[model samples]
Target: MKVKRSLIAEIKNMILQSREQAIRAVDNTRVLMYWNIGKRIFEEEQAGKERADYGSFLIRSLSEALQPEFGSGFSVRQLERYRQFFRTFPIASALRTQFSWTHYKLLLSIDNEAKREYYILEAVKSNWTARQLERQINSQLYERLLLSNDKESVLAVARGEKVPSNATEIIKDPTVLEFLGLKQKPAYYERDLEAELISHLNDFLLELGHGFSFVARQRRIHLDGDEFFVDLVCYNRLLQSFVLFEIKTHKLTHQDLGQLQMYVNYYDRFEKQEFENPTIGVLLCADKNDAVVKISLPENNRSIVASKYQLYLPTEDQLLKELKSELDKLDDIN
Candidate 1:
């Protein structure tokens, strides 16, 4: 009797499935092999009494010996990294299946246990790549969280027990723009800033905090036969809305608020989907007029916000002062 066509297809699928299983098994084994290598290297370094110097010497010798035999993947620095990897994450089972060695390498740079755990949890939860994880770390995601939330809330986010409650949880005040490579001078064109932001788009998005994805730059909008351009447009995945931005080098003005409000309204009416949250307009200016900003929009306004940008990260004292100010505001009811 001849085999049915379906049986042939089934047999082919079985072969493919076995091949896939073998590939996965090999990959897992390789990961385990590296883990063991790191463990052994760490132990040997400990045995030598001077752990750091011993580890450094061990890696150098191993690289010199292995590089000739094994062409690549045996650099002294990489060997040290593997050793540090084991030291940083001692629990083998805790390693995420989705993360590569590169992710671990970036994570090791974080010295604080809570901060490191936060990045690991978020990276695994959000499925962030190595590059994304690095960007967030560099942008001081942990510091921002610490500034805005209590210890318990920060821990909850790190342990993946709770998501950020609102935009404010994930967002940071005083966005940093040092990566744009712009001079901290008096005169700069809107296009110049736009061009630099585009050039350093990744860093900008990272500094913007979680969930922002670039949508458009210099987005042109027509209003009652008058043409205007919004400096930058981005969509926040977490908020599920468009974030309209207006860039200004000088102090934020009432006119800037009006223009941003118009852009937000246009997006809410025309561009945004019905399911999306209301468009959020952010005025990024060098200086902010708090009184002017407060009165420019309605008291019930939820769609517009004004944020000041800084060329550099603030000092610890300055950050502490800002954090205290924000916390104090929560107490002012009258």
Candidate 2:
């Protein structure tokens, strides 16, 4: 965790001194080596910069020279990757010490410049490790966050310049539950899904976006001597409201949305303070029709939502299709 580092050459000598510390030392050495390699390669490439054949020739010669001593990590392809890393990140001084090469490597895959910058800044702001950053990328967090909020609003929320007033601003529809360790099946009960969410509260919070704090499970209420149990309760600091979640393992229906809406109304009427916003309700179901969900609520409704929960992360094609569909809807509205 310490940025205090040694020369990469010192590894060969220290490898013999401490067998136990070798792995940790090598990890630190590897991170430093990535920046050093990238900076050197970029400098060399710029000095003799030319067309493809020349660039290829330079990298290949460098690889052959370093491969004899450093192994496959210095192969031509990897060397090129390091060079690109330096090009993308530019200055090593501006880099986060906590970010390992793994994080930068992931960032390189993102093509959109604003999207890439968002991930980089968010990773540092949230103190995400490489693995956590990868998960967020894989989950397409940036795009999902934009579903309820605009690009400027998303950045504003990140920068503390705005407060989100809607459920979709912070809640992801079709939320991924790969961490719940559940197999996709028709027979899983609502209780089973709720249990998995409770067991994996931390991962669920990440999936739920930001400012979510778990409040209660199977929350009880009374209406005209009829008892109703809410599946889960949470509070969002940014929204300044209580969020009620209803788990539905089956395909979502208007009735399901209506039921969750009642819970939101209950919380707002009985539990919320005058300064707090209205309560939000999320019907986390396995499947839903967007049209049905839309028509089930008031014309200006922003609190009640029926969000389908996925058992696994969506593939790139699926995410693209979803984005295109959203854009089409926006075009229609405009």
lDDT of 2 by residue, 54-113 (tens): 678888999999999989989998999988887887876787666777888899999888
Off by over 4 Å in 1: 1-88, 97-102, 109-111, 125-132, 145-166, 289-292, 313-318, 328-334
Candidate 2: residue 63 lDDT (0-100) = 93
Collision count for each candidate, in order: 0, 0
The segments of candidate 2 whose C-alpha lies over 4 angstroms from its true place after superposition are 1-32
With a 3 Å backbone cut-off (N, CA, C), the pairs that clash in candidate 2 are none
Q: For all the candidates, what are their Cα RMSDs to the real structure?
A: 7.3, 7.1
- Please write out the lDDT profile of model 1 over residues 117-190, one tens digit for every residue: 88888787667878888766765666666665776787785575776545555556677787766667886777
User: What is the Å distance of residue 89 in model 1 from its true position?
Assistant: 3.1
By summed lDDT, the worst window of 10 consecutive residues in model 1 runs over 164-173
Question: What lDDT score belongs to each candidate, Candidate 1 first?
Answer: 0.78, 0.84
Q: Candidate 1's C-alpha lDDT?
A: 0.78
